[model samples]
Target chain A: MTRAKKTWPALVALVALVLAACGGNGATETPETPETQAPETTAEPFVFGMILVGPQDDRGWSQAHFEGGKYVEEKMGAQMIVIDKVNPADRPDTSVEQVVDQMVEQGAQLIFATSDDMKDGILAAAKAYPDVPMIWSSGDSAWDIGKAYAGLPNLGNIMGQMEYGKMMAGCAAALKTETGSIGYLGPLINDETRRLTNSAYLGARYCYENYRGLNPDDLTFSVNWIGFWFNIPGVTLDPTQVTNDFFDGGADVVISGIDTTEALVRAGQRSAAGEKVWAVPYDYRGACAEAPEVCLGVPYFNWGPSYLEVARSVADGTFEATFQWVGPDWSDINNPDTSAIGFEFGEGLGDARADLEDFIAGLASGEIDLWVGPLNYQDGTPFLAAGEKATDLQIWYMPQLLEGMIGASSAE
Target chain B: MKRALRAVPAVWSVLAALVVSVGLLALAGAPPFEALVLVLDGAVGDGGRMADTLMSWVPLTLASAGLVVTFVAGLWNIGVEGQVIAGAIGATWAARTIPGDGLVVIPAALAVGVVAGAVWALAAGVLKTRGGVNEIFGGLGLGFVAQSVATYLIIGPWKRAGIASTSGTEPFREEVWLPTVGGTRLSPVAVLLAVAVIFLVWALLRGTRFGLRLKAVGANPASARLLGVPTEATVLRAFALGGGLAGLAGAVLATGIQHKLVPAIAGGRGFLAILVVLLAAYRIVWVAPIALFFAILSVGSAQLQLRLDLDSSIGGVLQGILVLFVILIGGWQALYRRGEP
Candidate 1:
């Protein structure tokens, strides 16, 4: 028995050695063949690679980016390679840098790292591969503001004027809310999140006072930050619970700032259950289709034009890395033909459809200014002097909740 | 000769698994040989990648070492995952609430994590012993409870300001950040702690009377009772010891690697540790190397996606095949021994 036991260890060692030898042989033979597979066709079309933080069909954040890639593919004739669902939480073993490296090896000249969570990874890849131009979505790393920000020559950041979208969403909520209460289903507190929430609140308050002719003091705009972009059971608050809490707490309208359609879907269910609840979903154009019965409208991003412009500039060798925060074209704010921000009205808007359109027209014509304020922050600090309009920088770094909004600015 | 004869089946089983995996790659329309090369290259191609592999290896090895104790005691502590999260929760609480320098904060947080993990595991132990519940079911259920508690804290009380987010507590003060080696994932102190844990576990299992008595209880409870061995106390002790180590792993993961809590802070490492223990054949001596191998497979598989455009699930497939083969070979060996007798 002792001899047999000893023999097994030896046999195990032999097997390991043999396996290693086979693997070594395979490794040595691989590099040569892949290089030959590259097509000799005239300066291979700028292979633009995109890394999405969630699934392409998620119908929210990631889907918007995926559609942008498809747009570039169709309009610019760019070769697009997109890898979706690249979340750090899901793939702990893989890093963003490693994914970028793979894309670079696959002949991608330009890479778009989509999702705010990808900031660090995108920056690292930009530093590692200076020759490849990279664009990071919803990042401010390229801006010359903080010491942490770097001016990478090949790295640029692109984000839409989503505050405007949130503002419109807020207006829609205000026009639809029967209980004079609006619930903002927020995701994680950041400058971006706070600004969006505040914008929505401002929009809701504007319409409540001006359009609906209701006392602004009688309106309640509350935000419940679910602590993440989406529900991750046990690590973040369940969106359904937050939605239920909002509705149960007497909010008639819930505006979603999250990547998923939980708020809209939950509102739809509540409506089916005979509760008069309406929702405004954010991100993708098709988000309202999830539950048109309760979705008042959706404030969606039109990333196609912006993405195509960048890709074309790169292809023509006229690309300059810059922080681009594109806003809607005022002439046609909801024009799918030209505008970067488009508001699609859902079927849930019973009689508020025309009113909502009038509000949008007023907003586009500079007849409405949401930021014109003597606004106080959550701490009752003066956020804006009387009649002072916030600049892009001021709005981007919004510090706290606006006055009269009920919820903790920071986690308790 | 006997050892070699015994190893023969395991070697054959491994070879068979590899053959099966190659066939799978072919079915998926990938060049199996090239894919193998890419995995190896990605795993160990450079210093940075090696650091990442070792970074993953630490927590996995620590968790698997803990699992070995429970397996030896014949308890399926599937709640190890929850224990790890509980440990992270304890550690994050300390890091966030405690006002101290790294020296004071690191040890204090880690200690709390260990205690929290032990306490959590003890619940499963109590359920098994007193409530007549199977440890697997009890552990699994408790694991879910632990996850909910973590989520609640993150979203409710511990959430970062201006944005309650799954991003976890605004990263612990930089002063308390685990001292890493020049920005690489490798933390000297964390690695040393893991090695120290492995040694301690090994010594406990192989070089002590407690180990022998526990083995006796596991081998035959009735025989152990006849021999005046306190089986229940030994089993409970095993659960605590194993839980303590898993908690320490959670502390290391939180303070060392992640630097902040995410919902996926444990990242299924606790569950993966079960596979590590299995690959080591439940032997404490074999746990570290086996864990490292799995880490390599994990770290290297990213290249499969990059180089060959193969799905990352291929790595999971390879790991599953390896474990399946080992179990099959082990069963075959057992049957052979019975036949010979």
Candidate 2:
């Protein structure tokens, strides 16, 4: 027994030494952070914090926001303090306040809480740090005239006018569909999603009548919400199954509004297998690269210009509490340095591409307006009087899907 | 001398884990000394950080304190996570549906949490004793079901107005939240809850005949039955008692920390408690300090990422290795003793 005890200590020392050597290797394999908060002697880079709700490379909304931060870094010699996957599902133990504390400790000057899901946490955090300028992207908490106004002086909102982008997606689906049926894969039931899906319906109805020279009444548009921005297996209805259901129901083109690209992948699979199908993915510009053959062009958010402007103002100490709902730079819609929204047409738009361009030109020139008069909501209530235009508030707080669409407007 | 001899393997286990940790820092190309300093500083660097560390300690200490009871009964209550979820659900129901305002709601909600957790665990206990199902498999299966139920409530019934997102239920009223220290997120009531639980568990295990009977059953259930111990009833009581403590931890998570019902509210702290108990060698006296050390690692991970530019998952890696080394040394000693006679 004494000999066994002696041998055990020797064996433990050997194993420990091997592990120590393994842990001591001089290699760094982690993804590169923009800049370290380590002390420096020269003029320090202007540091800012960004808390993202999903993975930074999710090829969707989070990726777009990440690229926007990278753009800010490029425009000004600034450093980014990025904390991704801050949602409850991913990092349940870590709260927004905890991450904000870390960011403040690292000497961040301005902070961006990018996601509608972070409304409560961002509000609490903004109040906690009264001097710091905090922007809650894709929220209406700072809109004084809005329904959910909190009136916090240091808190503000920044959101791209994704309404125009959705209109473009709807127009593309309308121009390309041969089955006269279109499917929309919505994320959830909210004012933001409701307005976007309603805008898509109006654009599709306008294009199917004028561009496609078809009876708009015969065109079918249906939307299905998957209860979240992305699939979480058992917790959510599988996006893959929903996309297939759309295609099997004879919808040749399906538009996606969620952060990820399930609709495009399934449509691509169906098209490759000799089915006439197409998809319009949302959020990221490079999402078409997933299945370009079946993509009907993507309507994406270009958050770079706004993020750059905010960074510059914050650096110059000229930042203020403002609700910035920026629109596309009509002069150059696809300009990375100018536009807040842009739609890049895919290769599958063989003959309808030119008509789609004409439709976009009409929208930019204000010759065609889809949000105009004589419209009814999904419940057949008068939405806008004849020849009347939609006010920003009216367009923003959209209560339901439009009359032509087939979907549950509100969860109730 | 005997006490010194008893501490030998623990000392060696900690030494091995420390050596491995330094090697890991070196592997990450980070200076080991500076990284260690950063983690230690970040964990308790200020009054606020100390509060955060203590807040993290609450759930872990309470869960492990409960684990001590189940372990003493020779029953692995893996369903602790499910019981926690059940407790949160029950607490949310009481907070939302209990009509009266803050004056009388908070304590009642916490009581509901304990009962919910106990009931959920007792059902699992019944499956083990009467239905011939192993607690491990039964507990695990029930855990999945509980998670699904939570997700359903968050997205379906308890979702925010006009929104079906799986973020969480609406935040509780400020008056209903656990009162915290001035200007900080630390709740003194939550800390007291954890301390009181540990004291109660230690007292119940050391000063009662029930504790003796539990030890007898744990050592040999067949022989314990012949000695006139009602084994099934004792097992059920252990399950209920263990689950009640887990339930309280869940209630603290909901009322004190989250202030709402979130799908992932348990935060995997239930699993972390299992590790803490294993590291303490199932000793009731050792649970608190070991849990505090783990809490420091958890709260300091954000700092590790910021200062050393290392991934925060390294903290989890360190935790797993520490437990692995302790168990290895413990099992080796057990094998040596068996060989002696």
Interface RMSD, one decimal, each candidate:
10.2, 7.7
- For model 2, the docking class works out as acceptable
Backbone-clash count (model 2): 3
User: Please, what is the TM-score per model?
Assistant: 0.81, 0.89
lDDT of 1 by residue, A14-95 (tens): 3343233223112211111111133334756668888888656678998899788878877766677666556645566666
Q: What is the C-alpha local distance difference test score of each model? A: 0.79, 0.81
TM-score of 2: 0.89
> For candidate 1, what's the TM-score of chain A, rounded to 2 decimals?
0.88
Error of 1 at B249 (Å): 2.2
Regions more than 4 Å wrong, model 2:
A1-42, A178-180, A248-252, A265-277, B1-25, B28-33, B99-103, B308-341
lDDT of 2 at B339: 77
